[model samples]
Target: KCAQPRRWKAFDGKITEMDTQNSLRGKELLEIYRSINTRGIPKDERTSVLLTLKWTVKEHECKLTQEIVALIDREIDLMSREVKECNLEGLRKRICTLFLQYIKIPEFNPQVAGLIKVPQDPLKLYKNVYFCHSCEKYLAPTEFPIPANSHTIGRCRSCYQLDNEARQREAYFKYRLILENLRKSEVDYQDDSKIVFLVQLPDMQYLIENIWNCQSALSACSDLYDLVMVRWDKQHEWSPWNTILLTKEEADAHLKLCNLQKTYEAPFIYRIEQKHIRAKNYFAQIPVMSSFLHRSSNQSNAN
Candidate 1:
């Protein structure tokens, strides 16, 4: 009902409200929303210009619906018997021509594509337009905007905003729990001689070596030794990292694998260290002390 600027005047409560708001100003208000009115023009010319504006205000961006136009004509016919049979078919034909003419007017700048296969029942094409579960409307999909995600294909902008808000709330809760637990947990890193070896991981081997080499300086008399192996496979990889060697000192620390794991876990890193290290291609070794025995680089650490 509140269609145009003049119609909105009814809801304004005061005819001079805009003038009143204009009176209050600041340093910036004096610069913006101020304009000169073109008054005292010829009456005929002014009427013609104002009528064009009214038509412009009434026109929807996607053009008027044919059903509304047909309804108007039928109401006219009921009042004046001079109207012949309502030309439904002719009206549809004329509208179809206009629709096709402006088909490319907006230049196909549409964002959302249809979610469902349209014209599911081809015979009902005349009755149903676009299907929107959010607004519960059967109008054109072009009336709504498209979303970036591929999952919910044809949802309107409002529905998309609602879904994103829900995700933000959920993530906030998830991260809060993580932070709460982190604050409660206590860890000990007092033993420097005991190398807490994290095994079966090559990538982390570099970091473990750096932590021992850079992050801390060990006494020359200390063993500088400790190791642990985590058996990770493609089937059990977890996030933060694909595989986690909870106590792996390095990936290629193959010699100390069993001995360090035994010390950390329970069974024995010492008893099995000699047996496994000498086992087959398990012959890779650390270069720190390649003393009495002779072996290739494959038999020892590169550095």
Candidate 2:
């Protein structure tokens, strides 16, 4: 039979080669080691590899290294006893955690600098940082959602997620998709539309669910994906007040109408106008939106 390679060369050298070649971190290696059953390996071989790892980690003199070394010694002591494998699992996990910490430090593991999330510059670390009242932690601006009409910062996204899971459970994704489609369509029109850009996600949700009752004005289509909000009078630019909810097919036909008065009955037009008035009443509260509302009303009166 062929002779087996020494445990140090087989395990320790293999780990080092993996770290050098694939840039595998200690945490990743720990996960890989845990996935396999180490019980099949002899105690002497395991101890030999662990000793080699201890010597390699000892090269760095730090508080983290000291903790890792102490845990390794404790693990070796436990292995020498008649304790069950389950009893040693906890100690092994602790050693793995400390070693991961040791490997994360750029001073100990220079290869991890690129992988670390924290910016090295102190100025960059503090820039755009805000405090989340709910979580009581400092986080980046991206971690908090600032609504278009918001005057103050709210809790972080994680806190909002926890709150929503516990309470609201609102699905606003459909409204978001609608708003996105509206913005893209407006951009394609090249009419220099402004109101759609100012309209936020919550506003769209209210417009669909409350003002329009989540149905097409003409066909009463309830499918949100097939529905779109378009200008009631194609001559005027789209705004909350001047918009009508219709299926895509209906919108195409509605936009082609040269005269809304000639194309629709007085009662049908009156009903749509009532919806427009409600939209105006709701959106006019927004200071910026109020200006657009006044301008649209004036333009409609002039026409």
Candidate 3:
């Protein structure tokens, strides 16, 4: 006798692929198999398979599941009657989204718990969490713009962005890029430069807009792309007071100068010194910088 073609004997008697595909529970398993196997299944067939799998997942019997299942059934009915794929696009997307959310729940799908990122220690999870007033959400401290001098945690970066859009509409991306470049350059210098890292986005914006007037000090070039902030005097490490805004070409020449006093006229040197004084006065307001200023004064007195 020929072997029964891949047949399984159930307690009732026998089970075949056709028998499994016809029953409701067996149809769900078949749909899952088709969803997982993408070799020859068409896009629409795969979508329908996924929709079937979404409602059939074990241990997920809730009102939300019922609503989604109803929606999927209605879409299937409409597709059968008219087959308008365009009209069902929105419904398909909603079903897929709901299914994704359904799978992400650890209770609904215990297998996914290891795949998702969650703090192993529950106590540590809340340690660095901060409250964002604007969004009224508790977020990580990294989400907030906490400057060196910030005494209290204010609104998060997202809230600040929303506030900017509503009011100032000012873009700080260019300034942020400039500040990052400055920090990287300072790190590469290998000198014990302390100020650039301490400076935040707002400080960089203030130095550029208020002190330098958003132009190259030497050539008065208004373009920010060609401009770079570098040490005014090569012997000293870069600080707010010791830096100059110059075009890339001008910066190379400026750094190469044997003597700034002789290379540039007295009037130009005087103007640069005035800008340095302004930077010193502005940054001195910070408590950390105040100590630095005090140490420098003591060293100057000692010398």
Which candidate comes out best when scored by lDDT? 2
What would the per-residue lDDT of candidate 2 be over residues 26-45, giving only the tens digit for each residue? 44444434532255567777
Query: What is the alpha-carbon RMSD of candidate 2 to the true structure?
Result: 16.8
Candidate 1 wrong stretches, greater than 4 Å: 1-38, 41-128, 143-154, 187-303
Q: Model 2 lDDT vs. the true structure?
A: 0.77
Model 2 alpha-carbon drift over 4 Å, by segment: 1-170
| TM-score of model 1 vs. true structure | 0.24
Give the candidates in order of TM-score, highest first. Answer: 2, 3, 1
Off by over 4 Å in 3: 1-170, 298-303
Model 1, 1-303: lDDT tens digits are: 011112234564745323222123221122211110233444444334433332322354444434334433443344254333343335334434443332212222111112234444556665546567876766655556755665543766677788899976754453343323222221122222111122223323342232223121112121222232222221221111222222223433432344544434444333233322342122124333242123323334644
> How does residue 178 of candidate 3 score in lDDT?
76
TM-score-best of 1 and 2: 2
What are the C-alpha RMSDs, in order, of all predicted structures? 20.2, 16.8, 18.4
Q: Each model's C-alpha lDDT?
A: 0.34, 0.77, 0.73
Distance (Å) between predicted and true CA of 93, model 1? 36
